[model samples]
Target: MEHSRIAVAGASGLIGAALVRSLAADGHEVVRLVRREPRTPDEVRWDPERKYVDPAGLAGCDAVVNLAGANVGSRRWTDAYKARIRDSRVLGTTALAEAVASLDRPPRVFVNGSAMGIYGETGDRAVDEDAPPGEGFLPELCVEWEGAAAPARAAGVRTVFTRTGLVVSREGGAWGRLFPLFKAGLGGRMGDGRQYWSFVSLHDEVAAIRHLIDTDGLSGPFNITAPHPLTNAEITAAMGRVLHRPTLFTVPAPVLRAVLGEMAGDVLGSQRVLPMRLLESGFTFAFPEIEEAIRAAK
Candidate 1:
């Protein structure tokens, strides 16, 4: 792949930091957009809330990737926090999209961050990129989030939505919180453990993003998840087996709802997601199975 200048919003995030590193290491020039004043030569200032991005920062870039959003799993889903979650994604995406559209010489592609939550509760059915979004708060939020990139798409930029799944890693995110609990033998399945979790290793997650950036003739939504998804119970077993710990506990559905509030529905929901488009595009995963992903995180 040719080394290209790439501008990335949310470069401090878990995936963004990794991507910036991966790109820089591979000789790609990366311009990081920060909310604060730019400290480094490659850094630029942008206030997504106010819908402002330094167009000069994006000039002459091959691609623009936006991963800015308030983390859904970071806290309890109170009404205010829920609004923050929605606004952060929608507003930021709109800001970036508009900026990309305004550029006289636009980038070749725009890869906007998204999530598998758009599919809502898929239960036991296997769904792919072509499936219509499911109902409820998360799915609705995802729709608004992805739709915020309309300006870029309308401007003829090859926009791609990375409908990512649960990224497996030890640094941060949902799986990060589990490593400690499982090691202490306090880890167990949530609810009835029947809900499926579509997961991809952090390595694969960053790889898929780079793949989307580098590959030609790829646009629209791509499920950035491992092909094989496992039930919650199966995941629990894998955790225990990998850590040599006992999985003897379960967090009931009622308790989850009580603690997480509106967020619990997503915790217990099933999404047997398949990365059909990504697979068809010939992207191979470094960690395709739960055990393999877990070990990589370790």
Candidate 2:
């Protein structure tokens, strides 16, 4: 893509914030979809719940990326909070899909955010885009979340869903919380540390989205993960080595369940996903190893 105009939802988030900066630095015209009243010409007001977005703001954009959603690990998952997590993704996606569909000239591509959680509890299996979704709240929610973008797909727009992995970054997300703990020598593996954690650096995550936008003749779900997936224990060891801390502590699964409620299932579950489709499409990762990603995050 040659410095094309791009519209982004969820511009305030960790991935969204970095993606916006990366796109702007590369000279792409960036427009942010905000929940608040428009603060500038580049910001557009939108209400996902109300299914309203000023289509004029998105007109003639080369691509529209939707990353709007609630943070899964932000708090203990109460029933209401779980509903918010689901609504935040599905409703926001539906709203954006409908808005883009209504445009006379929709974006050439729609890159919507997804997660590896869709293939719930893959154990030690290294799955990719072709794997079927496993059973669980997260899996079912992911199916619905991706399906929410039907309006855009139905409108003949080239739509893609990025099944992103655990983004390793110090700014925010799950790894952000782990950085401080590891720096203070309090970090350790959760549960027995056997579960796999598919991860990608923040740089790679942003780069993959741009690749999806630029690459043509590609649609459907793509795993935005590193080629190699490591178990939690391995990641703990890497963190200890990178931060010069001891990885001697362990958090039992029972304690995690008691504290995180239903969300503990995700924390202890395994999904050894790989970026098979992404690599085949010619997207390269700058930090494919755990150590390199940890060092970059630091």
In terms of lDDT, model 1 sits at 0.94
Q: Looking at model 2, which ten-residue stretch has the lowest summed lDDT?
A: 44-53
Per-residue lDDT over 1-298 for candidate 1, one digit per residue giving the tens place of the 0 to 100 score: 7889899998888899999999999999999999999999899789987888988889999999999888899899889998888888999999999989999999999999999999999999999999999999889999999999999999999999999999999888898889999999999999999999999999999999999998999999999999999999999999999999999999999999999888898889999999999999999999999999999998
Q: Model 2 lDDT vs. the true structure?
A: 0.93
Global lDDT scores for all candidate models:
0.94, 0.93
Which digits, one per residue and each the tens of the lDDT, describe model 2 over residues 1-298? 7889899999999999999999999999999999999989999888886777888999989899999898999999888998999988999899889989999989999999999999999998889899999998889999999999999999999999999999999999999989999999999999999999999999999999998999889999999998999999999999999999998889999999998899898889988999999999998899999999999999
Model 2 lDDT at residue 184: 92
Error (Å) of candidate 1 at residue 207 is 0.7
Q: What are the clash counts of all predictions, listed in order?
A: 0, 0
For model 1, which pairs clash? none
List candidate 1 stretches off by more than 4 Å.
none
Clashes of 2: 0
